[model samples]
Each structure stands twice: as C-alpha cells, then as structure tokens.
Target: MSATLPNGSVLSLATTYGAAIPMTVLTNAAPPVATATAHGLTNGDILEVTSGWLGLDARPARVAGSTTNNFNLEGHDTADTTKYPVGSGLGSVRKVLTWTQISQVMDPATSGGEQRFVNWNYLEDGNASERSKPTNRSAKVLTLKLADDPAQPWNAVLAAADAAGTPRILRLALPGGSFLYYNVYVGFDPEPSLSFNNIMQLTVTLNSAARFIRYAS
Candidate 1:
C-alpha cells in the first residue's frame, strides 16, 4: 500500500530491511493505526523490526502491519516453482514517483474510470545505482505512491478463470523482460485482484494519446 510517513514523506512498501521476516499484506484497512492517512502497503516496499525482529513504533519499522510478513527476499515465487524459484521471490518494481507528482499526472484524465488506472503516466520507481563492489552496478529504485482513488478500488484475489467483471490489473513492465507479471497480492487461486474495484486489466492496447498526453489543457 502507499502511505505518507510522519515526516510528510511518501513511503511505499519499498524500504530497507536488513533481515527477513513475515510481511503482512493487509487489504481491508489501509489508513493504518499510528497515522491518519490511508496507506497502501504494496510492492516495491520492505518491512522489518528495529528493536528486535518485530517492534512497535520502532525505527526501520513502520507502525502497524502491512508489508511485514515472513519474506522471501531472493526474488522467488512461493507457488511458481518454474518461474520464480524459492530463492528468488524478494524485491519487486521500485517506486518511481511520489503522491503529489502522481496527482499532477492524473489531472489530465478526462474519464473518471480511465483516470484511476494508468490514466496517469506509470512513473517508474527504483533507479540503477553505482555498484558498491568493483565491476558491479545496481539500479536505484525510485519511490512510487499510487492510491486507490474514490473512483475505483480493486479488492479481490484474481485467477485465470476470473474474466467476468474485469479488474484493474497492475502490471509492472520491467525495462528488459519478455513477460510482464502484474502485481498479485493474494496469489493465484486466491489470486489478488487489482486495486480499483470497477476496472480490470484490458488486453486491448491504448494509443499514445489515450494513455499519456504531452500537452494538457
């Protein structure tokens, strides 16, 4: 989920966690306890305890449970044995923009429906960083803050069989990848639906102008 920290700083699920632990992906209540804002604990975020492994209101740990659960930082899928191995389910698309910036991107949309989806430019999070080790470099994950506007909110675990209602699919298009994996919270069978309730991922592609407007009135 997306939430602005106490410092008025936008903090997504993408944070620094020195170790591994259980990450609680809550779908019902996002506003959180410590703060008043509705925060969404989602991809591109990390969770850990500062005092021990799970502390209350401690550093390096955001109050309440959102992205705090037994994690698999290796970038593996617990179910997908073929694709995402066990040791490769950690880390995901990085946050690219903040909530305020995203608001600007949404201002141009004409339809309240389309406006909810990638109606705004899918500002990428995470960026490549200079490798600390010799002959090694990494990407710097930017901070992204996407919200479930009142217009729409996806709430359900999706599956291949689920094609009736059509849910807003949140896909992370990596720069260099043949296949794209939409962010699935609950997972297949118990497949997690999109964020918006009314919108489902449309296979039909969107034109340049339909997706992004270089100049908006």
Candidate 2:
C-alpha cells in the first residue's frame, strides 16, 4: 500500500476566464449534451457553466464527446426532469484561462460534504426500525489558514475574488500530480489573528458552489 502527503501540495485560484460561449440548449439525459453554435471545445476542455437551472449554474464541467456544435457535460446527470426541468438549463460556458498560486498557506481544513438521508418511521413498524433514503449531498467548505502578509500579490487576488462575489475554480494539486478542483466563492476575515511570539495569520474560506472534480495524474 502507498500513502500520499499533503506537505507538497499546492493550491491555486482561477484568475482569468475566456470569453463566454452562448449555450442554446441542454438535453435532459444522463449526461446533458450542450448546444453551442460553432463551439470549438475539445473532448477534455474544462468549462465554467452558467445556467438558469440552479442545480447546473455556477458549476465547472469537462467537455466530452464533442462535436463542432455540441459537447457533453461530463459526469453531469440531468435525467430527472423534476429536479432539472426542460428548457431551464440554458446558459453560457467559459473556459478557465489562467490560475494564480496562493502562497504562504499554513493549514488547510475541509468540512461538510456528508451524505444526507431522509428517514421515515411507520406506525405498524417497531420503534426500533426505520426506513431511510439518501437525499442531496452537502456542500464542502475549505478553510485555509495563511500567513498575514499584505505584500503578497495573491492577497489582492483573494480580495478581488471576494469583492466580485462570483464563483471561480480552486485547484488543489497533490504530490502525485493528481488534482481536486472546486467551484467556489471566496470569503475571508479582514482582521488577522494576533498572538504573541507567533506570526500573524488570517483565515480564508472557500464555499463550494458545486461538487468538486477530481483528476488523476
């Protein structure tokens, strides 16, 4: 068996996005096919999707089975019409063009994303027995503790993202060259923590807008 450490990992934030390509239609299928006239995306291109459907908006997806005018939203399931109504998923998609590394990261903690369930208890059944079904998964939140250095260029990047209040991509690169990418909105405490004999630090929170995407080396 092998183990990987987080010591050599790096975190980066998306800083630039390409021009938005208008998406005309999204089919209700296991993996939704998007229609964009003259879309030049390839099989493995990553796109930030914006849609009228709340479940699909602000989500980052990879392109698959691409054609000149259509591509699949890889791994996205929109087959349930109750959850994703037809004609409500129209929006635009943009390619993430650039990323800026966030340095001086001290400790990173992740929470939530647990599977939630709905429970039911029947009158005929014993009190000890109950039925349960899985519901929607919880969102993941990543909190990063970093040295409070105002001189760092990434500080401005964080501030700008927070001010914009838009969902952007956050990537965590592991030691083995694998990656976990999150679509998130940035927020942070403006005041730094003060402690004697230790360097000042601040906490930045990345609230996920959609499920994280993982890529192998």
Candidate 3:
C-alpha cells in the first residue's frame, strides 16, 4: 500500500521554458574582404566597420523630428570656410562585412538598385523572440554591408561584375530579425559641398524591402 495526496500529481506552471538558441546570421553576399578566417567574417558571422570617416552622423537618414543636430564638421573648408555649418562633426569609417559571414539576405521578387544590410542586432543571443519564433515570410533585410562612400556607389560594385549594366544582389536574414536594404544613390553628406575632411559621414536612408522572420529554439 502507498500513501498519496489527491494533488500529488500537480505540476508547477510558470513562464520558465527551454533555453533559447542564439540566432544565427548567415550570408553569401559579397566577396570576402580579407579571408574568412583572417578577418572574422566567415561561416555566416562577422564584425565590420560600416563607417569610413570618424564622427559625424553616418546614418543615411536621421530620425524624424530628432532635432539633436549632433552633426558636426571637424575641419576647415578650403573653398568656403564662411559657408561651413557651425556644428557638423566627424563622419564614419566604411566597414565591410564579407558575404560568408551571413546566413541569408532578404530579397523580393521585384526590386530596384540598392542592396545592403539593414539590421545587425535584430537577431542575437539576448532576444528570446529571435530564437524561438518562426520567421515572417515577408520580412525585409539587407543583403550586404553598404558603404556611404560617395565615390563607390552601388552602380560601381554591380558594374564591376555586370557586363550588361544590371546589378546582381544576394539575400540573407538574421535569426533575431534584421532589415535587408539597398543604396539608391550615393552623394556627398548632408552638407552643401564636399571637403577633404575625414570627419564627414555618410548615412544610409533605409527602407523595408520585404517582410519575413524565423526563430531557432
């Protein structure tokens, strides 16, 4: 015989669940900048510097109504010092993340000419949703690391390999969620004129290209 309680089989119901998996980011977008093993940009993982200058506002577009005016210019203008803005600082250094370091970039059946990486932190270890949820089939994510370099426009990169003047792109999605984007046109910073200052930054004006997501538990 055994002594038992009526509620002995009850189980504790709480929010606790299995450990979440780290979101994986993979891509095959661009040529390896250095070597996968050498630059930590291989096997679908990478660390890159999208900025080339140093300080100024490097993002393509500043947040709407964000009147911080944090933008600044660090050097003197040789052409017209009087016209230079009173508060424009340094720019960004162009950092490139090779193609092998990403899982898969996002792409739509229809498109234009810009290809870039829109989200780097969307899929990571800290986010539970990125690891356990199913990816939305229509999420937009960038295909490669974009350079705000007014010199190396999207046309140049695509033209490098294209004999027919058409651009080719790659697609990949980060597990934690990210944006896939493209460069429409490259030009000087928000400033009125171009200068030799290294502090000038280039910003990527990002727009969604697709809607999709996936989670690994």
For all candidates in order, the CA lDDT equals 0.24, 0.88, 0.24
Residue 140 lDDT in candidate 2: 85
Candidate with the greatest lDDT versus the true structure: 2
Q: Which portions of model 1 show Cα errors greater than 4 Å?
A: 1-78, 90-98, 102-217
Best by TM-score: 2
- Could you arrange the candidates by lDDT from highest to lowest? 2, 3, 1
In candidate 3, stretches whose alpha carbon ends up further than 4 angstroms from where it belongs are: 1-155, 158-198, 215-217
Ranking by TM-score: 2, 3, 1
lDDT of model number 3: 0.24
* lDDT (Cα, tens digit) per residue for candidate 3, span 91-209: 22122232322211122133333443334335455654332333334423322323334443343433332333221222233333432222222121222224587333333222232
Q: For model 2, how does the per-residue alpha-carbon lDDT over 1-217 read when each residue is reduced to its tens digit?
A: 9977899899999999889999999999968999999998898777898898888888788889999999999878898999999899999999888889988898789898899999998887877678999998788889999999888878888989999998889888899988787899999776799999988998899999887778674
TM-scores for all predictions: 0.17, 0.79, 0.18
Off by over 4 Å in 2: 28-31, 42-44, 52-55, 79-88, 115-138
* Per-prediction backbone clash count: 59, 0, 64
